[model samples]
Target: MALTPLSWCVGAALALVCGSSWPKMHSALAPENEVPLRPTTWLPEGKITSVTLPKGKTRRLYFTLKKASAMSVTISPCDLPIEWSLAARTLKDKPLKSLHWTTKKSMPEVWWRGPGTEEKIHSFTGDAVNTFSGPSHPRTSIYILRLRSKQQSTRATVYLHEGPGPSGTFPLLPADSNVHTLGVGMTSVTLSWAPSPSTTSLHNAENSYNYCVLVNSLQNYPSLCAAKVSMRKEKDQKQDKKERRVTVWPILKEWWWQQWDTYPEDQSPSASLEDEYDDLQCVCDGTDSVCTVSELLPDTQYYFDVFVIDRLNGTNAAYKGTFARTHEEARPAITSLREGELRWVTFGDLRSNSEQFFSFRPRGWQQSGLLTLQSCGGGDKVKVTVSSKGQVLTSQGVGGDLVHIWLQGSPSYLIHLEREGSTTGQISSVKDQALPGALMASVKMQISSAYHRRGVPSLPSTLQIKSFNRLRGCSSVTLAWMGTEERSLYCVYRRKLEKLEAEGVSTLTAPCLGPESRSDTERVLCKYFQELNPRRAVTTAVIGGLEPGRAYVFDVYLMRRWGIPIKYASKMVKTRKEC
Candidate 1:
């Protein structure tokens, strides 16, 4: 049974009062108790150590205090989201109750359960969560730290210092007041606030408080602001201010795998915000009362929280917050790129309908080129689609602000760049697609014919569309294709003939197919087929939920396991009229 907060506190207090020696415990419950132990290591004092936590596995770390002193344990900054607990065992304390004592080389280790003798100091779980203060014993004892990764394998850094940390109460003062913006720009916001009077005494540079500026695009500011800030006071050293770059291939592979079928509507607004903004929360230090928050989205409101933190303990002394919308951005003129030339393109000003299109022609027959798109960081907001002759070669969202696409000889390839819009409930005053937030990035788009020398990857020879049902139901159609390759990936795209004509989209130039469009006539159905049976030479698929009495064009693209769509076949079909 899990203990309530009150019960847990009461149990811990009783454990401290009835401190019993481990050796005095029942023989069966002694240190030489159970079988095999999990991975264990000793945590060194006064140095930083990096450790890896296997997925869903628990690792033990032991640290011995030489004397009775206050020890400070700091879990350094990391991206892995994990759960960790700190416990201390003294010579006079008995083995924690209900905890399995597994021995390794005759030494006992605790596993999970504990409602008795062991004093549990603290526990934390979440992404980028760090600890700065540890349990303190009046006398020397062994501190055992256990780390468990939630679902994925990740690395963690730990700093163990044997001494007293900074002296002060957590959140030393009340919440800050008069938190307001000083100025707002298309991509930045300047904020100013009054410092708590209690913090004025520590104005000296040596003992100054560091203000942690927490910014996020979501409205869940309270919990975000309440998160611990890990700031270590390290000696001055050269800092690498370079931003991290995201590669495009992994994202492209993911897009190809998902087949670009679902849209933002398939997910809840809050859940969408959580996933997209997981890395969007940025923390910076404002040593003074004023700070400037940059790299914000144009015409979007962002929540800001400033916490007065002590440098020593990394504790939030006080906090203040406000929300402000960025200024409207002017649409930038598109500059055409010549072959082998790199050009910077600005994306994300919705007032001017910031979707920009560019076309590229391969230099040789069936030639190939490497198309690279790069951003400062958080490039997932910029969506890219490369198409030739109305068939989408590839479409995917860029992660880490970087992506690469290999273009095979399409006489000319059309590239579309646009800001992915905010979801419903993001901004109540604006429509769902009206406000595009936080994607104001000057992404670099470049196309080079270097792949021509590398040789274009060959298309599958046996893949071809065999036939389709001429008579179709009001909402469905059947298509059959022949391919000997059992491991290839396939996607079926459907576009309305009437809408294609109205938009002036010819059978030869339609790349705009995907769920991104608002109208069914313009939307591309992202139907996927994978893991074809090797025994069967023919594969069949039924396209459903289509409009009746509508003439539609369907395209089948054959892709390799590596996510490159090499061979494709297109056909036009008309759905039967509604009865």
Candidate 2:
């Protein structure tokens, strides 16, 4: 059970009224008759001591100092379950300051009683250190130290040390120094540190000191500590008109990281060296124990070090360095797509009535295609239509930003955009295409257009090839296209125009054949064939395994169920010399 705040206050008052020594009846219940003082050589004149308390009991100790000054005290538990309080007071019973702490187990009995019998238990076990300065006194002065517990019987130990006076020399090195990263991001990191011994153990004005922080990239740059700033001077003209003086300003510490441009020109280092020390070093207030460093690159590792500096003496003590890595940004799946290859065409922008076409040459065992419209901008009411072989497959108004259209097999397409009216103005479209079980093509485009007087087409228009890119160092190229119908058949043909002209091969026309028919002249022109079902508005294809450094012309023809004139789109590409 826990005591209420009012009840706890009452208990503390009663303990104080009981005096420094317990009565015989209460003493008899305690395991120890008196508190013990442990001898130690760590303190020059003070002593280490301890006291044991039983349930609901308290103990008090008195100290007489030879001189008046500030003193440091550390109180720690002896691995026993208990709650304790420490208080300071003058011999006349004038209260000074007090601190309360506990070592209670975190988990309750219910945590270990259930099915999780093997669960680990946790508890609070830590120590506290404090410093207090007393009023100056010529004669010996008396002080009081009190310890109390309300729960299980336990022992508490205390360590006392004389702190440095106002004029004492600073420590040669820092103690109890710690550094750690508080937070990390792609371009910035926050850091925190505990106050050094020299800062906490001595007495001085708050603005008398400053701290220096150094940051360096461990993976690349070597030294980031090159820039330096000169101190400014303050002078009293009335005292000495002929004399000159200078004084360095105390550095200011901020709660968050600051950029170099935010620093004052007079207080900052040389501007010529700004880039050299942009994120390398910073000077902060001595009282500030936390700061942030920014302007870091993503996916990079960096090291940081902190030093306690005494501005008056220009003396500094360095703490150990800490390291952290920034996170990397996500990347696309495929960076490049070769021409004459079957690939999903995804991610491009198109304008109203702007015809986009692509030629796809299917390889062995390749089938199926997908077209997706991810988003559109300009807030205009827009509709997109896809067609092939003069047949409209899909023509629907976009209700939201995202739209998906699937094609059963590889087929060339002609995609067109149509807005409600000319007032709809310029719009941007983002679309992508993909093949089943294959990599997607990178085809991002930004389309800007003014509505034209040409009315929206009532039927599917002819296929148009939008763009063609040859894969570097490979005998392949990628093609992007639009406008196709659902459940339509298409064929891809590639011919070396230069080679054919050089060999004097005449153009031959062959009659259309059935689905399973193969003619010698048809084989000469037809490189690949595919049938599209449940059609899409956009398509992209890759053609590979051709002779390197050779120029080839590609033609995509939409096939119909009955014999009809071939409606086709074509593009020419040159393969790279290297594989």
Give the per-residue lDDT of model 2 (tens digit) for 288-308.
Answer: 778788777789887776666
For all predicted structures, in order, the TM-scores are: 0.32, 0.28
Q: List the residue pairs that clash in candidate 1.
A: 248-403, 390-510
Candidate 1 on 142-253: residue-level lDDT in tens? 6788888877776666667776763343334445455678888999888787765546655453344445566655432222212221111111221353321211100112
lDDT of each: 0.55, 0.43
Residue 253 of model 1 has an lDDT of 21
Best candidate according to TM-score: 1
Off by over 4 Å in 1: 1-38, 91-117, 128-135, 138-141, 165-180, 185-188, 193-287, 293-297, 301-323, 329-579
Give the worst 10-residue stretch by lDDT in candidate 2.
Answer: 223-232
lDDT of 1 at 322: 77
At residue 299, candidate 2 shows an lDDT of: 92
